[model samples]
Target: MAADELKLENQVCFALYAASRAVTSLYRPALDALGLTYPQYLVMLVLWERGPVLVKELGQALDLDSGTLSPLLKRLEAAGLVRRQRCAEDERAVRVYPTDEGGALRDRAMSVPRKLSGATGMGLAELEALRENLVRLTEEITAQQD
Candidate 1:
């Protein structure tokens, strides 16, 4: 019974992990045309919504650490989609700002949500409910860690 409980098929984390990967894969082809990866798209989304943000704030917002974010930001900078510079007020802090080209990408990315929704074949309300539930679950798990 204990072994049965330990099976991969029975783990919610495994289910979530697999589902996350599968959902990300759906974005690959679409993101490919935009010259972006899933992580990069996520960064762009944050920048698009928040304007210039400190690197630490960006990491906190995205639930990422500098080790993971640094390389990704470097790549985006190289692509001319974003710029990273030391904050004048606090030289120790770095701020990331999206370029004009990055802002322009938003128009091209408008169809991504529609494409993903079509692929899921789920209605907006249903998806919203699911997202809310997942957000609650994530909050609960993170709360336990604190």
Candidate 2:
């Protein structure tokens, strides 16, 4: 076969995109149980790791925009998992804090990582390697975007 860098099958970006969608599909049912989508689950992970963060910070962490995040936050709020309030010092900025229900949901969410590990049937070392590779690729992509 002739070399063609522009070919879709030769593209790393397409591979990454396909893999990401597959991985998110795996999480769909797991997240649905918690009444959250994959993106919402990511938001929960960020907030759980760092409590009471500003909306902008959450958006940055998730690499999403306010336009996309605002509606998701509203859904999370309606589910009683999170609360959004205007920051005291900066009224223009909104802060997102987890509710007691949200905090409790973390306990339920904790099982997900382990369950997914089992479902994937990949050992810890292999999983770590995959994570490291993905992180490196993500950093490279972000650097290119800059």
Candidate 3:
């Protein structure tokens, strides 16, 4: 029946949502060891790759809004990991930069991906393909918002 098609177990969105929560939960223990939440870890990963970045740029990279990012940045600052400084060229914009301690945490965080991959029991090629598909899915959905 048509009504049967509406079951929660049949929804793609529900599957993605459940998987996302499970993955984040799995990362909790490893991230907690670094004194970072999953969201904080994401911010740190961007900072580690790009060095100092404007808050707005960071938001774009993480698909997060200022309201959500503000508290995370504040917590990072409070923990002595990152510093937020007013950009000299654009005084209205704030740039976030990692401190020496934050950079040092990179070494400890390096094992996280490996540990997570092992837990998933998926080969690198399969994971890479899955990531590609998910990225395409995200881009297509995001384009629809335009």
Candidate closest to the true structure, highest lDDT: 3
| lDDT, candidate 1, 37-115, per-residue tens | 9999999999989999998998899899999999999999999999999989998999999999999999999888777
Q: Model 2: residues >4 Å from true position, as ranges? A: 1-11
- Alpha-carbon local distance difference test for all models: 0.92, 0.90, 0.94
lDDT of 2 by residue, 1-146 (tens): 45575585568778888888988999888888888999999999998999999989998888899999999999999999999999889999999999999999999999887668777777889989989998997899799987
Candidate 1 has which clashing residue pairs, if any? none
Instruction: Using lDDT as the measure, name the better of candidate 1 and candidate 3.
Output: 3
Q: For each candidate, what TM-score against the reference?
A: 0.91, 0.89, 0.93
RMSD of each: 1.8, 1.9, 1.7
Worst 10 residues of 3 by lDDT: 1-10
Sort every candidate by TM-score, greatest first. Answer: 3, 1, 2
Query: Can you give the lDDT of residue 56 in candidate 2?
Result: 96
Best by TM-score: 3
- The candidate with the higher TM-score, 1 or 2, is 1
Error of 2 at 38 (Å): 0.6
How many angstroms is residue 105 displaced in model 2 relative to the true structure, after the best TM-score fit? 0.6
